[model samples]
Target: MSQDYSSRGSVSRIDASISVPVRTFIFSSLLWLLVASVLSLIVALKLQVPSFLGECPWFTYGRIETLQRNAFIYGWASNALFALNLWIMSSLARFELKSSWLPVLGGIVWNLTLTYGLIQVLLGQLNGFALLEMPKEVAPAMVVAFLFAALWPAVAFARRPTGNVFVSQWYIIGATFVFPVITVVAQLMLLWCPTLGVMQALVHSWFYQNLILLWLGGSALSAVYYFVAKESGRTISAYYLATVGFWTLFLFASWTGPATLLGGPIPVWLQSVGVVAALLMLVPTVITAVNIFGTLAPRNGIAQAWNNTTLRFVLVGAISFTLSALLNIVFSTRSLNALVRFTPFGQAQEHLAIYSFVSMVIFGAAYYILPRLTGSFWPSAKLVHLHFWSCAAGSLLFVVAGLTQGWAAHGRTDFAVSALPGLLAASLLLVGHFAFALNALGMLAADKAPSNRRSY
Candidate 1:
């Protein structure tokens, strides 16, 4: 019953089976992206003009900022991952999802619960933790919903009919297992059961970093591994290095969280361990960079980077990953951490990771996955280009502004000087998101209008 999953000429059984669920997740994520972007714009505007929403309690910078970030993480990022990872795992395994209704149901529940949580956030009912800000009331439902959505991927991998396990599968499977564990532990320790004094911070830090690196970063890297090879028509160079990279990331990434509290109330030994673990992450970074860039080597990659939209996005994501990793290592150092602890540079590093590295890779994967799933080419090539540039430019501008703001901490006390770039970044990001939403929705619309659909 097994068939090769490599053929893209027609929708496979696997694609057919998962289509509704994947589409559900994708559309939900697009809606959330719009919500997050608007919130982001409001946040940026408030930064620039503090009195803009001063009268509204709901729009207060503190509350809205948390709302926007959570909306992005839980809403945009999580749903996108569900769609991408589901397709990737099922495609790689050549396994038809027997219970497609599971993910569809799960996606609905997840989004509905997240909506309620965000409302609570606006009402100031939050945990006050970075990245884990959603009210504890919503945690269990979201977790259960995620498991329902995510379980099929693991089943596909374990029950795969043929072929050796790919590196991308390794990352996906690892993430599927790791995320729930950390999320449960963090919620229990930080919210449900509650931990003692500094331990709460420690758990939050551990959970936060792993959520970024292992859960989110793991899924992004999985996409990168698959797309870079698929688009380049070349096997990942130095494939053995992938094992090293994957294992190193899985083992070391969890410990590196403590480094965020280097000078804080955390134990010195724990901080030192985090520092070492963070530095060790360099091993995987260099390994991944070599494997990816090496595969995209010579003139072929350069040409693909220009001609292939998927390759272009994946390549930029690869570059961003390297930069984010390097910046992470740099910031983990004691001297630099002391200087930039409470600064915008820290936020800038996060923006680079979430927006530039993870989001770009997901975008590239979506471009490839959606067309295959829908049996249609993108609605307009122009919209695709516009989305890419707007997002790329916006991400760069935000990161640049953050770094500059951090460095100018001593000299720049003026609000206008600090907030102007952020406002511009937010505006560009909003435009880019609109372009993406239109293009994505148009593709779905074109799918319905068979006369309008184009060949892949």
Candidate 2:
């Protein structure tokens, strides 16, 4: 692994052939992430102040919280992956964005629809659940718009030079072509299907899980596989293991969400299947993580060569995967759920999975990929360091706060369906959530500045 990377470092840098749909998607995606991060910051503040925005209908916690999470999940992460995927596909295929305007249009439509959906959520015109907040009509509309935009990438991939297909490219290409199609179909059915009953919850979970895994996780993992291996100059020692893991993740994880609702009013079998899938995820998640970590294990040259933002964030992300897998199993257990299910402990568990592992890895990948996409180096190394440090420390603080207070509030019998107990939990959650939002904002601000700018 180290040897492969060292050689690449010594090789000359290559300028992008040109911007195309791929780069277009990536840059647009990051821009949406900025907007989403800002919204997240607002939501976090609302959690603390409750009336931070003077009781505007759209600015309330219910409204803002829904928007904040959606923005990050759909707006930020999906698009970030989209952007990175487009750029890599373009390079692999040796094609410019076939129609640059397509990605632009897709970006416009995506942001417009997402903004409208957020407004609907804020207006209290939509359901108020975690990833299911977007109304049916709007969700489908966004999907159609993205499909129209994604066509260019499909065409480019088809047209790209045929060569020894890198394992990463295979997944990336498959995800790029099929992802929007899946999202569109699922959402349209969700909107029109009266069959969506308690199964509505099932469908909802399926959509959310697939969106993250197929849409975001697929691309992000592919990029990490490509970059980590390529940058390290190591062809994955166990490429077959990596591929098998991918299939395992996709198959088993598709049925995994109902497990989160186990012991709730969903079908027993739904929960049963989901529970099995959730537990099984450990196999692939660990396998993939090991493959990446092993490749980067020899720090002899990586520290100096792949040393900057790209590798550092990747390492943090890689380590976080193990934590997420273990936590997923722990939280999914029925024995542990009695006290933690509705408590901040659940919140702690999810945050570390998304923010610590998934988001951070993508962040690291962006530190590397975005510079190539944007035709400029990161604005500030010191700022990047600040972003990494404050976020890592604050998240540690937040997760600890969530678990400790969750244990306190939930463990005690005094916690019942009253506003006071709710307030206690809410307040503790607020502190940790605020810390998270502040650090994310700092990172966003730093990304826009020059790499040599004044430290945060």
lDDT of each: 0.87, 0.63
Per-residue accuracy of model 2 over 173-235 as CA lDDT, tens digit each: 666655666666566556665445676667767766766656666666777777777567766
Candidate 2, which segments miss by more than 4 Å at Cα?
Answer: 1-31, 49-54, 151-153, 299-306, 411-456
Best by lDDT: 1
287-324 per-residue lDDT for model 1 (tens digits): 99988898888666767765888888888888999999
Q: Distance (Å) between predicted and true CA of 139, model 1?
A: 0.8
How far is each candidate from the true structure, as Cα RMSD in Å?
Answer: 2.7, 6.3
Model 2: per-residue Cα lDDT at residue 146:
71
- How many clashes would you count in candidate 2? 11
lDDT of 1 at 418: 78
Error of 1 at 257 (Å): 1.1
